[model samples]
Target: MYYGWNIVGVGMVFQAISFGFTIYIFTFWAEAWMTEFNVGRTQITATFMIFNVAMGLVSPIAGRILDAFSIRVLIISGATCLTVGFLLISFANAMWQIITVYATLISVGSVLAGPLAAQTLAAKWFSARRGLAIGWGSTGTSIGGLLMPPFAIYLLLNLGWRQAHQVIAFLIVLIIVPLVWKIIRNTPQEKGVEPEAPARFEPTQESGGQAVQWTTIKVLRSRNFWIPIIAFLPALAAFSTVQANLSLITADIGISQQKTALLMSIIAGSMIVGKLFFGGMADRWDQRLLYWIAASIMGFGILLLMSQPNYTLMVFISVLLGLAAGGFLPLLGAIVGGRFGPEAFGQVFGLLGPFLTLSAFAPMLGGWLRDTTGSYDSIFQIILVALIPAMVSMAFMKRQAPATQASG
Candidate 1:
């Protein structure tokens, strides 16, 4: 068995536990914590806003730190913060404490073990199969989404949100920290394993004859850097808004809360297929085409939900949107890895952190539009329109080659 594939396997576990206990479980905790803290609707939702902001703001720093330090260091530190954050949040006396601790510690922890770190780890192990490895690792998000919510809800119902968090923290400390320490190697070279290609040993040259290793300034100045940042920004905003308002919009359409919850499960289930299909196909097909197609499909799903309003189309919409949602990050990572090579992937991908700020605000905009117009119609229309430019970006964006390759 390839050691790289082992990293991919362990990475999947870490990602699953990381996302499950933190972000995915937050959905369940939101109302529970709100009631306990006596927070208003806006204040309770602000925790997510804070979380997104923290995740986004800390992203590049996490990337740079990961590049500078050993992978184990970041993983351990992140896990520690997450564990502490969870433990502390469980005992929090005020809403501000939850907001403050989560805003700082959990956000940092998430960046350390979240999608970027997982993809960066997987990216280090394989080049020929980078997409698949990333895709495989990414299925953790779906897996977590599929399993964790129900479990979290059960805990919330039976033991309470605080106790539920303590339980999750215990499992994370017992399970996640050790797996990361034992199984995750920063790069294959730690085990004397060679990469899939030769250039990983030497800096690859970009089109302008610049070394393609990491430098914050060089990446910030590149077209590839900006394209993905810009591309993912609105797409994520729309997606974030959709997920944030999933229950409200469904209720407005007269779908029962039970049905909406089931549909969310369907959406979660579909992500596995979406991630596997898009992730696997990327290695064999045109990634750009897949990226655009997924986004376009998302537009269709958004339209279908708003237009139909009935639960009849709910399952199909969930499936389509689920696939699109699942495929998104894998595609984004694949596109980055392909265009820029793997050397600076963390840095390049880290640049995407700031856009998450927009993602946090997107739901607010959607809600405002919904309230103002007395329907989600405008929100749907705006999101659909947002996809058009995003598709154009993928269609027109070039896979930047190393300068030597460019000259040839």
Candidate 2:
């Protein structure tokens, strides 16, 4: 039991660092990249769009690799690619160079071993505790969000964005590679253990075949598979937009960059708390209720963000929004595992990846809207509208048994 949590913990750390750089820090880096590369804000934000396109386009390939390769191999490869992408971005001169390194390479690295890989690994290790386990692994993301922004801000100030990239490159090489190589196992049976559960939710396959035999095509046909992806679309849009634009949004209201970074750090910090509390809540409460309540909080927070432009309000709204948005990360995974069971979690979850990644377009859209219309108010209103559908969809999730209940 202890070892299982340890395994999940290590995987979560790997996820935290990898995704922190990929999604969260890109906002901080965007302003610096604009200055360094002599590009406009839109141009720099465009790079993030490429990153999204890459993640959406390449997820199936990532799924295939996850199914085919050892988790360690994929993780190490991902870490290496991530490290190199950061280094390459540090030295990039032309727009295409930035696109190649930051957009294409880093996107591939993240999808290869991002949250999907980590949570799926944790899912295999615990049957009855699957929601809690996936929730715990997902918290690593919030932890990274909490921790990375301040670090990135400080690093950018002290070392320049280029050197910060180098620092991250070195860290990934030193940390993730060795830990993943040592800690992750492909499956429990490999360690001379029986299945975590025998005929608990679903029977152990005759020969321990791939988790889901259904192809991506087959999985796409199932509403249960697609509904969460659709429902999550607005949340991802809100997250992606806010991540890229929050600092700029605050700056427009006369808040300094340093204060903006601090506000983001506070928001990210709240996310860590939110993840832990909500994750525990998943164990005890109906996930559907928790999701609706969380979404409502986020929607209101975004509405608050739209209304206020001052430092005081930014700080207050930041923490509130953080807590509201943070729970969705783990809750989405729990919903997936609960709805589908773990028999083919890797594939089903992978199928959901592209849609989630594509939702990141919200930020790029926000940036373009800001560039065009000169305010973030409209984007927030659109997000408020978008979120209503998402909350309603949560109610539509079939009243099927939670996966844990099925096993019980």
Candidate 3:
């Protein structure tokens, strides 16, 4: 296999391993923790809040660190912390113990090993195929989403939740941790290799050897940056609200838990296809047009989700939403990378993550609305209304043509 492809493959594995423990498997533990620990849903969700905090806060710092330090150290350290955190969680008997293990330790570990590292690494390695490489590497999320839920459910059935964590920890330590420590490297320069390829757009350096750097402040000040936020915010609300309530929504319309789970699997499986196919297609498409199309598909998916919530409808909506969910991440990254260049990517994108993460609160808020209003219809309508602004805003995010540089 080509070295670049190898890197992407390993990166995908690492992401799967990391996210499996952090998210997909955690849902399996939700019932166990509440049953055993006598905790509430809010308490269980608090762990996810801690995760968001750590990930959002660490992103900018991790970006700079990737520039300054070797990726091997970051990857290994992250894997170790995540694995150890899960193992420690297996021994948890108290609320504080769960909080420490799930919220604090795993939270910290996930930040170091997440999308920022994988995307940044891919950014450094590939120039011409940057979008495709980044997309492939980042597909770890979809893979983890597909595999971990069923695997977790199986482990929960057979060995119990705690034991599942222990097993997952062991696998991570034995496989991903060691492989990363041995194989993952920082850059071609660090490996004593000459640059064998050039980018489509090379840096315009000054006489004093400074490449033009786009500061986080400068990027934030640009209209292009904020315009996309409008699309992202409502899209976040729509997608997350549906995901959080999908099983419930289906069950309300009389589907059994078994069939609901199967439908969820259908969504996850479709994501694998969406991630690979759409990710590759992104590199060749007009990014602005692509964003609009993706957003439109997402909106359509939400509309479908709101329709019947029957078995057939559930399958169709799941496939549609799965395509949206799988495609959004890499496409968003490409929009940034193509517009801003890799040098400024970390800071610009880092700043954007918190707003997106805030979408988690949308589901929580939607739940509150459901309780007070006694129906999910209003919330779904609100989400649909929000998409209009998102579409309009996305249309405004095109890159400005650069001004000519004069000779000194």
Better of 1 and 3 by TM-score: 1
Task: Give the least accurate 10-residue stretch of model 3, judged by summed lDDT.
Answer: 198-207
| Candidate 3 residue-wise lDDT, 104-166, digit = tens | 668767767777777777766666577788778778977887788888788889999889889
TM-score of 1: 0.94
- Comparing candidate 2 with candidate 3, which one achieves the higher TM-score? 3
Tens-place lDDT digits, model 1, residues 135-221: 898998778887888898888889988888798888877877788888887788876877665322222565567765656787777
lDDT of each: 0.79, 0.76, 0.74
Error of 2 at 269 (Å): 1.1
Best by TM-score: 1
Please, what is the TM-score per model?
0.94, 0.88, 0.91
Q: For this target, which candidate reaches the highest lDDT against the unseen true structure? A: 1
Report the lDDT tens digits of candidate 2 across residue range 1-408. 646687789877988899887777787776676666678866776777887888877776776667666877888888889998989988877767978786677987887668878877776777666767777787787777777777887998999988999999999889998888888876776555554552134322322333445656767777777778767788768866787777778778788878887887888788877777777677567788988878887887788777755778787888877887778877877776666655566677777777787777788778778889999888888988888887787777774441222323
Of the pair 2 and 3, which is ahead by lDDT? 2
